[model samples]
Target: MAKITYIENGGTEHHVDVPTGLSVMDGARRFTIPGIDGDCGGACACATCHVYVEGGWAERLPPMEEIEHDMLDFAFDVKENSRLSCQIKIDDGLDGLIVRTPPRQY
Candidate 1:
């Protein structure tokens, strides 16, 4: 499992141990983290799982795919670090990854 930190827009943080092979969205749902609704159930079909990769983790994550990129267009307050949580799969390499949720998801 990898330790992932999810920070809310208001500064609340949730640290969770996400099992390998699961998406970040899955971890959030498992832990009941707020701000990530994951309406598409990890299908990358919606923008409800939007998150901002913090620190250098954004560069460390795999390149964003076309589907996720397009989906993000529907998210609120998108930034350069913006990403769909469903597109981020957990692995040993992603240990200590930090992500911040937007103020709201649309």
Candidate 2:
């Protein structure tokens, strides 16, 4: 399992042990972390699970696909490190991954 740190907009942090194969969105949902609604599940169909990958983890994550990139257009405060949590699958390589949710999900 990978240990992921989820930071809320206000700086609240949640450390979760997310099993491999599940998406980052899944981890947040499993732990009931606020700020990540994941309304469409892990289908990458919505921007509710938007987050900013922190530190060098952004470069460590796999490249964003066209679908996720396009979907991010609907997210609030898009940034160079912005990514759809549902599109980020957990693995041993991402053990120390850290992500922060935006102020608003709309």
- Candidate lDDT scores, in order, read 0.95, 0.96
TM for every model, in the order presented, reads: 0.98, 0.98
Positional deviation of residue 102's Cα in model 1 after best superposition, in angstroms: 0.1
Give the worst 10-residue stretch by lDDT in candidate 2.
55-64
Candidate 1: stretches off by over 4 Å: none
Model 2, span 54-106: residue lDDT tens: 98899988899999999999999999999999999999999989999999998
* Residue 5 lDDT in candidate 1: 97
In terms of lDDT, model 1 sits at: 0.95
Candidate 1 displacement at residue 47 in angstroms: 0.5
Best by lDDT: 2
What is candidate 2's CA lDDT for residue 46? 86
Model 1, C-alpha of 44: deviation from truth (Å)? 0.8
